[model samples]
Target chain A: MPREDVMATETQLYTPSTAAARRTSGLRLSRRRVIHTSLTYALLLFGSVLLMVPFFWMLSTSLKTLAEVQTWPIVWIPSNAVWENYPAVFQKTPFARYIMNSLVIAIGGIIGTLIGSSLAGFGFARLRFPGRNVLFFLNLTTLMLPAWVVIVPHFMMFSAVGWLDTYLPFIVPAFFGNAFYIFLFRQWFMGVPGELEDAARIDGCSTFRIFAQIFMPLAKPVIATVAIFAFFYYWNDLLYPLVYLQSQMKFPVSLGLRMFQTANAGVVDMPKMMAASMMALLPCVVIFFFAQRLFVQGVVMTGVEK
Target chain B: MALRIRMPKTKMARREAMEGYLFILPWILGFLIFRLGPMLYSLFLSFTDYAARGAPQFIGLENYTYMFTKDPRFLDSLRSTLAFVVGYLPLNLALGLAIALLMNQRVRGITGFRAIYYLPAVTSGVAVAILWQFVFHKQWGILNAILSVFGAQPIGWLVDPKWVMVAFVIMSIWGVGGSMIIYLAGLQSIPTELYESASIDGANGVRKFWHITLPMLTPTIFFVLITGLIAAFQIFESAYIMTGGGPNYATYFFGLNIYFTAFQSLRFAYASTLAWMLFAIIAALTIFVFTTSRRWVFYAGAREDA
Candidate 1:
């Protein structure tokens, strides 16, 4: 039977006369609900449009001629769309190379973060250890420590080791588990039933085997969340790249876009700049749309669920 | 062989501890090398005259003293950062909650709206900052064009000292969709029974929101506030990319100051001092929020009186 039908029948059984009266009032209630819903939609639509103007403006500006971009009454749409601006972005700078550098850093970071964080998280969640609680607390506290606190020394260390102008500074730190991602993994791992581990143990599966074969497979969601977070972090990162990388060839998309802007200096070409910005943003937007559920879940996991 | 002589329970405990350590070994190494070592080295550097060249001279407390007494840029950076936090946080929280409420409504196409809202939050920061530069152009910008429809004159958003921070705050609202998702998650977690029972007690929507929803969401609000405040204090990319700390240094944020001091000027010691100062401010503010959170943050299952 349909669940709604069963619920309706149960409701009718409890109070037949009241149910009939409720039907009449339900019509009025639904009318109010409709009105409320319409008001909500109107407000939401208004806000969404208001919020989306920048993006729309970006797209519009990207396709406009230089003169049209500076026209008095802003042209909503260019009469002749300058689709060439998209290709022009590449002609002007090593944007393709920048995207590749960003990808290398982001992917390398994700791999390291997944390996490091998952191992630590599994250990914390499932193993018995001396000072485990204290250690975990210490790890958590590091999440609040500002990056600036250690950035100077990190730069000095990297420069001393001649890792400057390379992706090493960006990618190498991920091998050390990030406190936030570890926390996420640990939280997810903690929720798995103890019986699964016990069953595996009874079959003589080693702890590492149980973690690798059993827990890791079951942690696809958290893994996805961590990977997405890592991607976002590395992809959007500007400061680290800005501080470490000096060569234009070593620049990530973030620094590359900045270089494009400053390269022109006073004579700003608005359309081409918009086009480059759009290109730089494309991968992130695409990834987000595809993996949005993971993004939302990751954010919620960071909240005070415990 | 030694473990085999011990009690089985103790032996198992020892094995688990060993396994735990093995699993977390990577993290432990990372913590020591990347985090703890750098932090101590940074602290040491802050008290020296290490200017990225031949710097071994220890200048005890001189950097801190100069920062406090003589550096006008330090004060300016602090003023701008505080101004940004003030202008940005409340609006971000309120708008995030408002949009979350709208999204929580049982309306069709709400997911589409949610995605549209979140789209900006996930885009590359450098790209978005560059895009906003065009939007905030004095005369040719879409914002000005729209304002002119109401007969308001064009304002120099990035160029004007008074409006640069306002421009930044306006740009920031585009990313409020991030917090909106978190708020939506918090809203979903609230038990429907609370609202049902409140309806039985003749509570209106506003009363229910005030008496139940707001209190229930305090923990989420607290989380958002802390994270948002930390992020706000780290503002650098937008100011650097869009305005270059601008016309008359209006947008010279602390993060930018730290960057310029360390990288551009090669004043590593002074920059380290600046960074420590930032860390102190962030830590103090975070500690303050955590202390105050006990009064306002509501945990659902925890003892109410406690």
Candidate 2:
């Protein structure tokens, strides 16, 4: 049965070696390829549209009037787009303050992660210490440790230090290095040629000097990857901010948006809520588009290379 | 000359070790103070009756006992979270792989399609939740509008307990683009020679995909599955923002329960217990996956131990 099936397929795919028959078969094969490619494109387009519906709805709702948002037919396009909703979001809540808070936290996180992760990663990758391998292994294990386990104690610890309601919790630990980013940096640093470090040492460079000047400069891609991850983590984080920060003014955009939604629940101010969401979403989306390559590299590195 | 060289070599090695220690000092300090200290403290807290007021009175195993035997929300939260994991995981993996396969085709403007798909993954989780909340609105949602176009009645997505989990799953799948990118990377890394050889053996497209592509993609699938499982278990921000743990606690995820217990109820010790339970569940499942992975995950050119 298998032989017969194979023979049938073979006959169907190709005719016996006459030049004219071969030419017709070749045409048929090309046509088949064309159909296959077209089908792939069609499927992708359909998936893309389905995937993008939420985003499209967000944008569409943000531009619509409140009346348009609640209309029966679900207006795909508002006849009179409410461009004022974007600016009005700032007026409605402390949206500007939220954005500012988010930026500060994000920047602090990026700076801290870069410094801490790079230094620690460089140490693990390049230097020999007594318990280096054990320490590195511990770091990787912490990657699997759930954040929930540490959160309550962290809250207590911070409150004890009078650091609650501040950005200290978010920013301080970042300066100490994250397990995943440190791992990423270590992996990248390990790949750097030993010759460079040797040359730097021979030139009378201190270890710190070699790291600051040579390794750090050469790790731009990994640095970009780490920085982007840190930025997004701080910017988008809700649970941490929710647990730690108490003051409304100190809230990041994430917490602020949640507060906004909670405050306006049942009222359903769809346009203004969507406008605020769009604003909150803007920076990360813009950064992603600009650093698309680095993002993909970082994601793939975490998944495939790990 | 030999004595002098040996002395300097020893001195250099010592210096290198000292430098390594210095570079990684921040990480060690952070790990001890932030991670280790908090983890141990939380464990202690889990056995106490701390409420963020005054002193934590030790009340060993009461929290754990209460969770298992008495606490009304505990089982509900666990069941809801597991239901979400069950509903969300397979669909996410399948859809992510499907999109990745489609995006793997050598079609023109493929990167554009990829970027469009991935746009949502980078957005703030809070913002995405808010937008989705609007999209799932019963009376005026675009989703119901689309359904209406097909002569279907409006379904109360977020409002109805029966359909809430489905809504959450659909929202989660919208961001499947992140996994799709990883799968695409895995797909590209596959050696085309496998496909070429399969074709030479008269293997059709479906056979080639099953025999060659699926086996080769197992490692990536394993990676996605593990990470996705971890992330899914920690489903908080979306549920918190979108449903506030529900119309009637239908979306009361474990993370939300932990948060409410810790903050709202001010049962810091009990929250710690809940947190540890979550950690235990995650760890067990992770180990389960790791052990099972040996049978399925394939690595090209990998050593036996690896």
TM-score of chain A of each: 0.91, 0.92
Q: Evaluate model 2: give its TM-score.
A: 0.94
Q: Model 2 - which docking category?
A: medium
DockQ for every prediction shown: 0.57, 0.52
Q: For candidate 1, lDDT tens digit of each residue in B1-306?
A: 122332226878898888988998888898888888988888898899989888658999999999999999999889988999999999999999989988997889977998999887777578998888888888788888889999999999999988899999999888999899999999999999999999989999999999999999999999899989898898888898888887677788999899999988999999989998998999899999999998999899889883
The most accurate candidate by DockQ is 1
Q: Candidate 1 regions off by >4 Å?
A: A1-27, A304-306, B1-9
Query: Which regions of candidate 2 deviate over 4 angstroms?
Result: A1-17, B1-9, B304-306
Worst 10 residues of 1 chain A by lDDT: A1-10
Instruction: Report the C-alpha lDDT of model 2 over B1-306, residue by residue, as the tens digit.
Output: 122222225877788788888989999998999888998999999999999898999998998999999988998899899999999999989989988998888899988998988887777579988888878888888899989989999999998999999999988888888899999999999999999888889999899889988999999999999989998998998999888898688999999999999899998999999999999999999999999999999999887774
lDDT of 1: 0.88
